[model samples]
Target: MAHRAASGWPGVTAALAGRLAKLDLYHPRDLLLHLPLRYEDETRLTPIAAAQPGFAAQVEGEVAACEVSLRPRRQLVVRVRDASGTLVARWLHFYPAQQKLLASGRRVRLFGEVRAGFFGAEMVHPRVRAVSAEDGLPEALTPVYPTTAGVAQTTLRRLIDHALASQPLEDHLPDDLRRTLGLPAFADALRLLHHPPPDVPASVLEDRQHPAWRRIKFEELLAQQISLRRAYLARRAKTAPAMAGSGRLVRALVDALPFALTGAQRRAWAEISADLALPHPMQRLLMGDVGSGKTIVAALAMLQAVDAGWQAALMAPTEILAEQHWQKLAAWLAPLGLEVAWLSGSRAKRARAAELARLASGELRLVVGTHALIEDPVMLPRLGLAVVDEQHRFGVRQRLALREKGGAGAISPHLLMMSATPIPRTLAMSHYADLDVSVLDELPPGRSPVRTKLVSEARRDEVIARLRAACLAGRQAYWVCPLIEESETLQLQAAQKTYAALCEALPELRIGLLHGRLKAADKSATMAAFAAGELHLLVATTVIEVGVDVPNASLMVIEHAERFGLAQLHQLRGRVGRGSAESVCILLYAQPLSPAGRARLKVIYEHSDGFAIAREDLRIRGPGEFVGARQSGLPLLRYADLEADADLLEAARQVADTLLRDHPSAAAALMARWLGGREGLLRA
Candidate 1:
């Protein structure tokens, strides 16, 4: 016999179960939480003459005529008439059963939008059902649910209604708290949302301005806050090495640097230093805009760990970025008599084994590498700090794997995650509330601001001419493409084709091509050549989106710039403006831009500040995609609008603190009800 589903519902076959699983509906409780997308009003009918265009209405009428017409296309056209007026119903695609049901002389009730068509006022593909004069209308609006293929809206509504009837709906929050917040009971809210009364205004229900929506949004926000705050507390309870260095190495590195640390850098360094001194593990996020000098602060934190006789490792998302970090750190630390080891998948076998041996023996106190750092063969016996650059690119599991390499049995290493994409204030408060955040809001002195230019792809010749001129004047240029290979779906200019074209167009200049498909050695050589000014211009993909900086390269031409995100465009722009020369970043976009693409281009062109761009980006993409919430293993909000519901979020934050402190059981219950098994991912 086959096993019954966790939902304990009858008639759920293996095939039905598979289809339901696609919607994450495994248990009866899951069905209860599956809310409707929208509702259709069928409680009353309007006269055909009174129905307005561009609005949905329900009407009851007789089918005066019905026939299949092939004038413009094969379709089923029916003339529906009430006492007031006649309306045409056209179906470009129809079934035989539908035609028979909507035959002439049949009295039917239809619900759909009315519009002026060639024949007359019409509703294309209106839902029609045979009805008698005595047939009563629906008592409540019909619910339309979000579903997958093989599962119809009717199936979902039936299952949800069954779940609501069978399961007990109990309030998770305390009675006093619910009353104080001016919210209804949990059961009342769910019932009202699932089957709203006809008397309620559709606007309030659709826009989520109703009291029930408020309760649901608040509950979700409260659960998220509880999960994050509890994770924060749990991390503090863990033990870690107190890396309180004697200030010898930190002072030495700062004194030996060619440029002075800006005030923002100094403040960030101080915050990191304080965290390092604590006995508990430090989980801090260091955020800075492009060219804000976050790498140096990370370097100082690593030195503090090394000075305290502990190992430190830095993990980057890409080999290019990792190699860049290795080179810069190696150059700075080599003079101080400290060697930083490099690890990557492409490293030679003998060299990788040798480095692994050194790390295992605690002979190497500092190392920088890509995801290879998290492999089981690699070891950090005395690891005290692990810095992740472009932290958002790594998944939660990968980050945890690196932290687990501390090898200090029972003691975790300090984690310092750095992101060049500035997190908006609201986003930081909601998503990153678990960790301490330090922002580097200022750029270093003497660096020029890049001038942004929006150029249509129609002006490709002019851009190529400008690039040739810039390179001929002794300034290097970067030609960035969105893709490395041809894609049938997207007609983007590939890096290889662009490279060949540029070489042919400007025969006097030396141009190199770099992308993710290239061998590790080739990428490194190409980047080195560009840095050394051996190449006048370099064509690359987004592989150079983050690191691999060259002060001499001032002009950046991004082909198909509209395809990139706001943060990525800013980072690419940051590649320029690092030197004294006036840099220009030309964004080449194709014609016929979409509304979202147009908005993104406008934002990038108008603003140069990363924080302002980040806020706009959040507004455009919302919090989930902006922060990579799914990869970070955090549950995204389903009902709450982070921007519009900021007030409720604040209230939820305060309530989370109170519940965790005073009503621990209630907090646990709320988290269990909402997060279920997903809460464990937050420990990372």
Candidate 2:
């Protein structure tokens, strides 16, 4: 029988039905399994006494005048006569109908805190509930959850209640890992995350001790490590001679460079050449900071594959990047008489067919493309080396799809994954223990260091004057807007409006605006103009956060820097500092930055090391990402941390290795129970 498809709801219909719909929401349970959007504390409630006059505070008060304000703004403002005074507590966003209940003249309980107002002490918006004034506020620790649209916080709270109540415990971790790591049982840990004890401070738990969050981080690191280990084991099991590239190719490529490759790049090339010498396929992660010459190192590696009489393939996460690689490879490798084919979903059917034919005939030595390269119709005759850029964007399934692309019974290709995320060594070693890692930590000689400054938005005129001077000096700059357009609520700059203003301010200067919502061809065209120095200034969103490179653009003025993540801000800052010219990064922010936001901005000004920034990001934001990094509904360990609990991560790694090492033994049950102890299912 055909399975019923989802009808605008996940879990309500069979997943098979989702094939016809463009829905990413799997189910509520699936969402719980998805990597956390982020982790926040539920223990933020404070006493009325500790609340500052301007801050939101939960206070006990008597009902006075519970009238709805119809004039200035639509809100339910109840005059709560507290011990201090008769305070006007406004439920700013609440519906107007709630005014009737407030006017009952009876004392009601409120959950929100008092916030300072322009006039005096007031809670601009509060959550109110009618309770006996004598009962006061609820005294239990609440679990604030990660939610989605149409999924109310209340609905999530209830679902969590049910999952905790009815789900049977299935052990997924091995006993050795469990015992050695000092980890609680999976079920117990979930309970701790969902129903933490009252003694645990929300701040502390949300900051560091929240089991759900920590466990999820640990599991993610573990999964990646496991995939890496599998690749390592597979490599070790294979025997192949590493290619010895004649100096002719390397020297020719070097001689043609715009600038000399950095010492770090030289070292990375040596490492890659050495790895190829071994009989086993090379499985290495080339980690570097943005604009750190990682692409050149990869090109050099692919050159070795050519020298070895093997075909190489480069896969990217986006078409723009794929085209970029294709152009770069054609310029460098074409001189060596190497053929490069570009494939993507956007390619004409006939063009893709021709590329596939060339690929299968072993005529096209290299093929760079997006996910289109993994389609079943595309075939590689002798694909020996595979290099994937921005490895994090691709999933295990996609990787496997590519690995299995050659005809049946073909030997697996050597894999080299590259990332510019600059994960620190200690964390990388633990998180990616299976793959050999090479770091390009050096910049080429004569490359100027980017002078970074954090300026408050109050000093706009000074910054604007500086920008005008820079432009007049014929130095191009990037003015990055965090938001694409203006909003009444936020005072941040918009790329379009800023572009218009800059054009008006300096009529002689050419300014271009680029954002995602614009046409793709237009974005590409604008970027090309910027690269060619046709535009003196490029006003853009974070869309150019990666792959769009302009070495001449030596300045980056990021507006509302406080609103972006540390990693994202670092990526933006990287857009400059690539060329030999002196560069400056001005992080402009509105006044009164939050304590955490200030600290984030400080981290950028104080340090330029991407790995250090990454560590700090992990510390500040934890292991999960903004979204879509990890698949939805993967049972994440919420109790243990791989970073904080390295000992636990190691223990888990050992247990997994030992069990897999002893497959087909009676101990399999115990190992399965340990690793899959509490997991209902894992979504790839």
Best by lDDT, which number? 1
List candidate 2 stretches off by more than 4 Å.
1-248, 255-260, 277-281, 344-356, 375-377, 425-430, 484-494, 517-525, 591-596, 626-628, 631-635, 654-671, 674-684
Model 2, span 112-166: residue lDDT tens: 5456665456675566666574563333466565554455555556655665565
- Compute each candidate's TM-score over C-alphas: 0.94, 0.66
Task: Using TM-score, give the best candidate's number.
Answer: 1
**TM-score of decoy 2:** 0.66
lDDT (C-alpha) at residue 376 in model 1? 88
Which residue ranges in model 1 land beyond 4 Å of their true spot? Answer: 1-7, 62-80, 92-107, 484-493
* C-alpha lDDT values of all predictions: 0.91, 0.68
Write candidate 1's Cα lDDT for 475-581 as tens digits.
99999986423462232346667888889999999999988878999999999999999999989888899997899999999998888889889999999999999
